[model samples]
Every structure is written in structure tokens, then in C-alpha cells.
Target chain A: MTARIYITPKPDILDPQGKAVASALHDLGYQEVSEVRIGRFVTMELKGSGSPENRQRIEEMCRRLLANINVETFKIEISET
Target chain B: MTARIYITPKPDILDPQGKAVASALHDLGYQEVSEVRIGRFVTMELKGSGSPENRQRIEEMCRRLLANINVETFKIEISET
Candidate 1:
């Protein structure tokens, strides 16, 4: 089983890195790019099959460590490979 | 237009951060988690509709600044909202 977690800054938070990237894009002639938000993408492989318990455990992991609850939001996607 | 860029470490590269994350998961009782790889997720808002030329420009941005070609690979997804 594989799980992917996508974490992004809260919408109301200021993202300096994203701002820099947006500026760089404009300088690179990608003037169409008006805003940019940078985040984290995490992929993990599990040893066994996927189950509700595993999902819950992964969610706990996200809450405890993978994301900063106050400033970031996360989404999870799971698949069997 | 919104464009999402997912950047990941090259397969052959060593990722200490990922290792630490995997180890942490194990210590946290997520023994099923066997491996973990950490990467970047970037979302950008563009001023116009998605088009071939804009796509090309975004690709160029990825190649030149968004990703470290030698150590990372990036995938882009575009949409109009």
C-alpha cells in the first residue's frame, strides 16, 4: 500500500516562498502566473494491505507530525500497488 | 488558470529527510509504513486561460527554476477555475 499526503499553507497565511516563485515566474516571462503557493508532497509505502485502521493511523500521523495544524492543511490519497 | 507542480526526488538520490520521517513513523507505531519520500507541491494561479503556449512557458519555468534537474523531477497539472 502507498499513501500520498499533500500539505499546503492555510489560505489566509502569507507564503514568502510562494511569492518568490511567483516573482521568478514573471521574470522568466511567465507573466500569466499571478500567484503561487508552495507546499509538501509526501509518499510513503506500507508493508501490508490498506485498511480503515491504516487510514486512521495515517491521519493521526498527519495530525501529529506531517502537518502544522494551525498553518497548514493536508489531504491524503491511498492506493494499493 | 491554476497550475500545480509536483516535484520529487530522483530515485537514486539519498533523502535523509525522508529517512527521518520513515523512522519517525515507525517509532510512532506505524510499523506498516516501510518507506517515505518527501517532495514539494506548488500551486500557482495564472491570469488567463490554459493554453499550449502557457503550458510551454510553465514547463520552461520548471526546467529552469522550479526543479533541480539533476536531483528532482516535476509534473505539472493545469486547470481553469
Candidate 2:
């Protein structure tokens, strides 16, 4: 199975990198760009059978190591390979 | 309009960050995880009309600044806010 995780900064958090990108876009004549938020996208391949247990384990992985829950939130999508 | 860009390392590239995450998952008992890849997810808000020209401009931004073409590839998704 394959799983994808998206980790994004919380709405209230300051994202300097995103701000820099937005500024750069404006400088490049893309004046329409209003805001930008940068985050992480993670993809994983699992070897064992696809079961509810494995899915729960993957979510646990996100909470434990894949995301900074204090300032970020994560979403997971799983599919067959 | 809102746009999302996903930037990921090329498959052939070495991703130490992904490796570290996989190792951490293994340590945490997620032994089923076989491989992992980490990338960037960027969300942007645009103030102007969502035209083909604006979409093309966004793609240009990805090629010129948002992604390192040599080591990474990017995908863009656009939608109304």
C-alpha cells in the first residue's frame, strides 16, 4: 500500500518561508499573489498487508515523528499501490 | 483563487530526510513501512482573476523559484476560494 501525508502549518502560525515566496512572486510581476503557506508532503510505501491496524499505525507515525502537532496539522490518504 | 503546489524530490535522488523519518517510524514500531519520501506542499492565494494566463504564470513561478528542476518536480492544483 501507499500512503500520503500532508503536514501544514497552523493558520495562526507565522511562515517566513511562505512570506518570502509570496514576496518573490510579487517581485517577479505576479502582483496578484496574495498569500502563500508552505508545508510538507510525505509519501510512504508499506510492506505488510493493508489493514486497519496498519492504517492506525501510520497515523500514529504522523503524530509522533512526521508532524509538529503544536504548530502543524496533518492529513493522511491511503491507497493501493 | 487558491492554488496548491506539491514539490517532491526526484525518485533517483537521495533523501536523507525521508530516510531519517523512515528510521524513526521503524523505531516506533511501524515495521511495515518500507520506504518514505518527503517533499514540500505550498498553498497560495491569488487576488486576480483565475485565468489561463495566471495559471501559466504560476507554473513559471514553480519552474523558476519554487522547485529545483534538477532534483525535484512539482505539480500544481488550482481552485476557487
Candidate 3:
């Protein structure tokens, strides 16, 4: 099994890196682009079959290490590979 | 329209950050986790409809600014909002 997590800045939070990219895009003639937000994509491979409790365990991992609960939000996807 | 891009290191590349995270997770009791990869998630807003050409344009952006073609691979999703 695999765990795929996305950690993104909250909508109300300011993202300097995203802003920098947006500005760079604008300077490069991509004027149509705006409001960019930069985030993290994490993939973790698990050793066994999925258990119902794994979801909660993964959430705990997110809270403890994967995401900063104050400013970032996370989503997870589990898959068999 | 919104474009969500996921940028990841190539499979053959070594990801020290991901290895660090994996080690931390193991220390924290997520022993089931093995291979791990860390990536970037970038969201950009576009001004108009999604045209066929926009995909090409976005790919160009990825090649030039969003991702390092030599070591990174990117996936893009364009959505209407």
C-alpha cells in the first residue's frame, strides 16, 4: 500500500514562494496566471494491506510530521501497488 | 480556470528530504513505511477558458520555470472554476 499526501497552505495564509513564482510567470509573459500557491506532495509506501485504522494513523503522522497544522492543510490518498 | 501542477524528482534520483522523512516516520513508529518521495504542488489560476493550446503553454512553463527537465517530472491538471 501507498500513502500519498498533499500539504498546502491555507487559503487565508500568505505564500511568498507562490507569489514569487506568479511574478516570475507574469514577467515571462504568462499574464493570465495568478494566485499561485505552492505546497508539498509526499508519497509513502506501507508494508502491508490496508487496515481501517491506517487512515487515522496516517492522519496522526500528518499532524505530527507531515503538515504544520497552523498554516497548512493536508489530504491523503491510499493505493495498492 | 485553475492549473494544479505536481512536480516530483525522477524515480532514479535520490531524494534526501524524503529519506529523512521516512527515517523520522520510522522513528516515530510508522515502521510499515518504506520507499518515500517528496515533491512540489503548485496551483495557478488562469484568466480564461481551457484551450488546447493552454496545455502546450503550461507544458512550456513547466519545462522552463516550473520544473527541472533533467531531474524532475511534472503532471498538470487544469480545472474550470
Clashes of 2: 0
Cα RMSD to the true fold for all candidates = 1.0, 1.2, 0.8
Sort by TM-score, top down from the best = 3, 1, 2
The better-scoring model by TM-score among 1 and 3 is: 3
**Pairs with steric clashes in candidate 2:** none
Give per-residue lDDT, candidate 1, residue B35.
89
Model 1 over residues B38-75: C-alpha lDDT tens digits?
A: 99999989887778988888888899999998999999
| CAPRI docking class of candidate 3 | high
Worst 10 residues of 3 chain A by lDDT: A47-56
After superposing candidate 2, which stretches have Cα over 4 Å from the reference?
Answer: none
Estimate, for each residue in A1-81, the C-alpha lDDT of model 2 and write its tens digit. 999899999999999999999999888888888999999999999986568888888888888889999999999989987
What lDDT tens digits, residue by residue, belong to model 3 across residues B27-65?
A: 999998898899999988988877889888888989999
Angstrom error at residue A15, model 1: 0.8
Candidate 1 Cα RMSD after full superposition onto the native fold (Å): 1.0
